[model samples]
Target: MPDAPTGVSRALREAPPDRVVEAADRAIRSVLGASGTVVFVADYRINGLWPVLDSRQPDAAAHALQGPLQRCFSSQQPVRAAATDGSCQLYLPLSVWGERLGVLMVEMPEEPPESVVRRATDIAGEVALALHAADRETDRYRRARRQERLSMAAELQWELLPGRSVSHGSFQLAGQLEPAYTVGGDHFDWSLDDGRLTVTVLNGDGIGLTAALLTAVTVNAMRNARRSGGGLVEQAELASDTVYYQHRGHRHVATVLLELDCATGRAQAVDAGSPHLLRLRGSTVSRVPLEQQLPLGMFAETRYALQEFDLDPGDRLFVVSDGVWGADPSGRETYGERAMARAMRATRLQPPPEAVGTVMRELQAFHADADLRDDAVVVCLDWQGPDGRAD
Candidate 1:
């Protein structure tokens, strides 16, 4: 029989975040021996992992744990390896469903048995789920996942976006923004209503505090329109007019608005000065043609024309910000559409989250300096049709 979800997390459910993590460590010790336990939580952006429990040495600098922790996370499997002190360490990926969370580690003085490892894995999953639930009540997990302090604008911007990822009956969507601590005005939002899904991506011009405000204004306006039963065209115009007039035409926001009917795979969009949409279908890569228009906050009485397309089962669509492809400030190179096309051809079969991660890595390789002047954002949509095929 399968191991029961461990009761170790039950007591921690109502406790503070730190106490919850401590309880998890204690549970690991109970199952796998009194091994020194450290829970490594994924940073908000999933770029890296950090030790969360207080018992972990302050100067631990356990950089070596990254590799095994990552493998455990991506593979959703238990990892057993030798620590620097020749002792055994067990790394269990902490996740529920396909939502990849983080990793849990326990250091044992000696190797453990299969049953011990199996129990520890089960306990870790339960703990991870509890932490996620507790997050709805406290800022402990949220604050801990942050790599650095966020500016006031960045904080508001974070609140404007949805939980980092989401899924529906037959479709999945995921998004990411880089330089999270200082992201200027990059944002993405999605909602599933009945058989229709609405998504919006925006990159407010400029950086720093003002840019963040522009993004907020744009998103809230769109949200207002969405809530009012507005169609794609109305949603775009309402957001544009609201920002353009409210900001006295002084600020603007580039955006991509989409309305997809999950039942028929029919899609419509307005490309308001953002990057062209890339559609990946079985081994081929192509850009959905778009007639770009002036960004929001620059023109009133502007009506955004809808571009119609269809999503085949198994198709993954990606919308990006100029930060991901525009020419570098140095003018020495550009991560252009061709680069994106090439990458899509290589990764068309992967899931939305992985594809987004790969594109970010490729952009880093393109710049080579690891310095991104603007916030980098990518939103991916995977649509599966009535037949349950994503073709």
Candidate 2:
């Protein structure tokens, strides 16, 4: 028989967020022999403090009424208090970049050493990352349930996108999708085939289940064409026909297909009613032109233009669904390409994930944290992949 685990260890393992917070406090106390610990998660309102974990409330949730944590968030700093029991209370701000996540307070029998403070900061950072991940997970859950009748189109769209993040050789890629519904009509994908990175970002016109269905068909047709050994431009034509005939209507869709040869540093792209591609070189920003033609679903007869480019080291590619550029923050006020360019320039040196974080921060700042009503998708590609033979 396996040895029974300690009751204390089991309790800690089964702890909720507050319990986890308290556990963190206990870890800090053990390392520094502190008296108590208090964790405050900043409320969304940015007003006051709410306890996340605390030893003072053994039976209660330890959460403040969204008041105190708001204060901590507004101050963008931590507040320390010393109780009358001769215990030293230290408040530390938990933030990533400039985003104030929350505050943590630990009470000790006596003043803690500088080492304790350093250790606390590290703990706070980890807590901040975990909190963000949790929040994002919650957001996804809420999004999935926002609309009744979970559309299969939405489910299929999610499955067809890239697998989380791709990190290999000299390339780093990250993508995100936001839908106005359980399924919207925006999709982005990339894969390594024959030593080349083939990328596709498409936005189907209209909304709801119909748009999603159209997008699903478009992606499949495009994939089939590519697998059939057709070139990028040829694949676009084949995919366009497939979508048009599949839908069998005057209804049309807009799409973009890009094929990147990682080994040769050469790329070919075709934009069908999609926005101009944002290309980055060092700090310079340029656009890959959208040639003459209608969106994928908009035309029965269409001529797709092929755009080719030779990428240099450290080049970056920023693509988005129409939802992003089309999303008006406060109605009639659009988040334009210029705004994206500025954000991209600000975090050019960071990886795709960090760069995306910077971009999201800038977007929020631009709107003063106002929510973008429409679905938004953004993908950042860094072509710093291996310096292998340029075939």
Candidate 3:
């Protein structure tokens, strides 16, 4: 008889990226004689969790996913709890490279041996790696986390955005856009080049597909320029010129293209009608002054200039869109500068991912009962300066 599938190698060999979770579930269930297995991955927005391969017909899996599963995510660790009065299960967090991806739930007839539980954790880690690898193309995974249906434009925009966060020893970056289900005209992109990390955030005015198309054109224009060996100012000009020539000053994008030297903390920024940045140091939060230039697509001859700044280790920079600060969609009538300041002060010490979520939650509550009138975005990075430290 053929040997039964086992371990990370066996599981990965048997499943495609789109079906990796289901493949993992079978592996764990076989080893533990577990009655069932379910994989819960983080939603696209990173705001909550959702289940994968919960095949129970009556929707029982949804009810089963609560309790210890939630604890696994909140605590960022593996958990063991009774699945029912007489049965026990284990929940393990799915993570890779310090990013918390989601949770794994294994329901067994009884508590398994310690050795078996340890192996399960190992499997969960492998599963996270697989999920991350397959995220971009897996409709099952993406559909599970989506809070609502996305418009065609929002779907394209979402596809262009990175996976919520990325980090290195010298710095950690996390970003989010609100009204999680539908978003348009707000996007951010990042890349590392020659020991420097480049980040660009854009906000296109107006609404619907037009704004999204403009953002797509602008970001791609910037990308093409950067690929051709241009710096921040040149990238800004290329995007601006592309928009101006294509739309004839009819549309524009507010942008901030920034490059940070992870080795030296030397920072350069080019602003095109974007909001002033916020800096948090120790326990103080303040707005750093930055000159604004004409937005992209506005004029044929507009030029953008580079602005320089310094980021000491432990300083955090907050880049946001006006929608984030505009407020009063249906809640507070204005998130206002004071409200934003208070939120920043409250979350100054949290890690980037946690801090981003906390800020989004507060904004959602503040905009209670109202549709997100505009795309709201927030991107943050903590500079660790040279020597490569993370806090």
Q: What is the TM-score of each candidate against the true structure?
A: 0.83, 0.59, 0.87
Ten contiguous residues with the weakest lDDT in model 3: 56-65
lDDT of 1 by residue, 217-254 (tens): 88888888889998878888888899878887788899
Off by over 4 Å in 1: 1-3, 27-37, 55-57, 60-66, 77-90, 96-98, 106-125, 136-139, 386-391
- Candidate 1 at residue 300, lDDT? 76
Report the lDDT tens digits of candidate 3 across residue range 1-391: 0122246547866688777877777776675577887787787667567777543443423323357876787566779997556787789988776567788888878877787777777778778888888876667777777757888778878888756777787888888876666788988898877788999999987777788888999989999999899999889998999999998998899998889999888899988998558898877887777788888879997888889888888899888788887777655447756777677777776778777777777777777746777788888888886766634
Candidate-wise lDDT, in order: 0.77, 0.62, 0.78
Clash pairs (backbone) in predicted model 1: 244-297, 313-390, 313-391, 314-390, 314-391
- Which 10 consecutive residues of model 2 have the lowest summed lDDT? 1-10
- Candidate 2 global TM-score: 0.59
RMSD of 1: 3.6
> After TM-score superposition, what is the CA distance of residue 242 in candidate 2 from its true location, in Å?
2.0
Residue 193's C-alpha lDDT in candidate 3?
76
Residue-wise lDDT of candidate 2 within 1-391, one digit each (tens)? 0111232234344545334555566655665566777666633222234565333444433344334343444444444455677666677766663345567776778665666566655656655555544443334322212233446666667656654346556576766565322547777777777677888888776676777777777878778877888777776777778767766556676667778877666888887777547888878888766574567755454568788877777888888766666556666566664787788898766767556556656666666676655445677888774662111
Q: What is the lDDT of residue 194 in candidate 2?
A: 67
On TM-score, the stronger of 1 and 3 is 3
